[model samples]
Target chain A: MSEIIRLTTPLKDEDIVKLKVGDNVLISGVIYTARDAAHKRMIEALEKGEPLPFDVKGQIIYYVGPSPARPGRSIGAAGPTTSYRMNPYAPKLIALGLKGMIGKGKMSDEVKEYCQKYKAIYFGAVGGAGALLAERIKSAEVIAYEDLGPEAVRKLVVEDFPAIVVYDTHGGDLEEMGKLQYRE
Target chain B: MRVVDVSEITEAVAKLCIDANYNLPEDVYEALKRALDEEKSPVGKSVLKMIIENADLAREGVAPICQDCGLGVVFIEIGQDVHLVGGSLKEAIFEGVRRGYREGYLRKSTCHPFTRANVGDNTPPVIHYDIVPGDKIRIVVAPKGGGSENMSMVTMLKPADGLQGVIETVVKRVDEAGGNPCPPIIVGVGVGGTFERSAFLAKKALLRHVGKPNPDMELAKIEKIMLERINKLGIGPMGWGGTVTALAVHFEMEPVHIASLPVAININCHAARHKEIVI
Candidate 1:
């Protein structure tokens, strides 16, 4: 196991530049949540040259549509949704200055190519570990698209949020590496 | 003949929904534990450990095991001797799903496919009904998540494709899916019947307990061989890579049309949530 790197949200170029694939990270601070529906809306806004519900520059968008909070809790079982569904909208966001994305599953080649070109990073969270992941989120408030139900965009305050670097700007690929290492 | 009220069905379905979401079935949990023990990679073991812990946390009734609570899939075995009264069986099940999702704090995942409109309540559940001999109704609720559901596929092979064709198609489906379906996945293979019936059987097979072999010795042996081939792909846990890519491969095969050999594969993530009730 490698040293677990600590990171704060709204990641800067320097914060992500030195990172490599397979590095473990504990991200703390504010991040935004958006799934398939919200992504489409955001992209439409950008295409129309209108201001987005949130900024893309130096921000991280987590692909998740959390269950409703259990009254006293700030969030419900919040975990990463499949990232591939967001592949189409990701490169557009990355090109517009989104520096990091947190989600599970494989990303497309275009998204990966954009990440390499723009010095961005893609982190894979443990899929299906929702109840456990919600522990890292201190608070959540919908920032836009309330009608989207669980898929609404929310501003999330997190602490020690766990994830692994799956794709790095420096051309390291953990998915491929992991498969090759153990492949029969 | 015995009479059964739709309200009774509704109540049971509602409760089953909540219970299924909050607790991981013993079969699934134990299979995961066994996978953890057998997994060769440190990362795979750690991932499995997190899954186990998440299941424990969800049992506290405070959080769900996964955010994708799934579009509720219900399987009901209705006794032919029972007369259902007070409401339509279909609407009663929908009412149960609506209440269960709203009250249990489960996510409403159904939508207008083309418009992408939220359906408010998780209704129009994928309900499968079977006619049996008794006076009771047996309902099984299995919430199918999008991640694994998206990886499922159906193919119509020539009759000549035979057993080898079935094996190749299923193995290839998992291989193509890789980690996207969530590794250490439970694969359900359906053979024979019509093209659509085969797909249905593949899904129904997912309702079976993980790690249990098919009752038919011939199919059981094939299940074992297919499982070995899938794990050898080294998809590992969550595709992080390792030795335990799949925990189990289950099959439900039936005799089909002489000209058609249809194969359908449905993959379920390790979190496979399901519960059964008799009323």
Candidate 2:
């Protein structure tokens, strides 16, 4: 195992370019959350020339719809959702200078291509390890699309939020590489 | 004859909903524990470790095992000698689901399929009922997440296609699923039934204990073979690749028409959550 890279939100191109597939990352600072419904609305807003819920530049979007938080909790059993559903909207956001995404599962070839062209990265977290992952998130607040319920866009303050770079700007794909290494 | 109050059914459903989501079943937990040792990839091993840890944390009841608390799927086996009183059986199960999500802090995942409006309170559970020869009712609550449910399929094959075709179809389904359904999955295969019955059988197969074979010797052999073939796909934990893509392959079957050999594959993610109660 190599050293774990530490990063904060509003990530820079230079910061992303240095990363590669299979690199472990500890992301600290603010990350935004959005899933199926929120993504649809965001795409619609952009088509109509309205501003996004937040500035997309340099930020990472986590694909998740977390369970409700109980009393005295910042968030509830939070973890990554499958990322492929966001494929339809991710390329546009990547073009708008979004630097990274954190989720589980494979991305479409088009999404990977945009990541390469835009110098962004795709990270994968343990998909069902929600309770364990929740401990790393210090706070969460809904910033947009509250009508969407769990799919509402949330602005989260996280610390050492762990993930692995599955797709890097250099055309490295960990999902492809890792499978080949173990496929018997 | 024994009388069962609808209120009792409602309360039991509510508790089972919370229990299923907040706790990982022992069979699934044990499967993951074994996979950790057998997984070849470092990343796969670590992912398995974290999943195990998450189950441990979820048991404390602060949160569910996963964020997608899933659409409540309840199975009921009512005894023939029992009389249900006080209310509608369907309404009782739905009420249980609502109360469970509300009181347990689980995510309400049901919604309008086309309009995409949130149901707000995870109600109208998908209920399956069976009549048995007893005085008790067996209730099982299995909260199935969207990720894995999307990966499920029902296929109809020629009678000539036989067992080999079924095995190939199941293996292909898992291979195509890649990592999307959450690897280290449990595959439930239903064969030898009509289209809808096959689908139901596949889903019901998932309620069985992980890694346990069918009591029928022939079906057990097929399950063991399919499990080996699926794990060889190397989708690993969460699909990043490893030696253990699936923990088990559970098979269930029923008699079919002479011309049809319908098969259904229902995939369950690593966070397989189901609980049962007898009352």
Per-residue lDDT tens digits of candidate 1, residues B45-140? 888999999999999976999999998999999999999999899999999999999999999999999989999999889999999998989999
Tens digits of per-residue lDDT, candidate 2, A1-184, equal 6589999888988899999898989999999999989999999999999999999999999999999998999899788998999999999999999998899888899999999999999999998888888999999999999999999999999999999999999898887887788877
lDDT over C-alpha atoms for residue B210 of model 1: 92
Q: Find the candidate with the highest DockQ and give its number.
A: 1
DockQ score of each predicted structure, in the order shown: 0.84, 0.82
What are the runs in model 1 whose C-alpha is more than 4 Å off? none
The residue-level lDDT of candidate 2 at B258 comes to: 93
How does chain A of every candidate compare to the true chain A by TM-score? 0.98, 0.99
- Weakest 10 consecutive residues of candidate 2 chain B by summed lDDT: B232-241
Model 2 lDDT tens row, B105-185: 999999999879999999778999999998999999999999999999999988898999999999999988888888899
Off by over 4 Å in 2: none
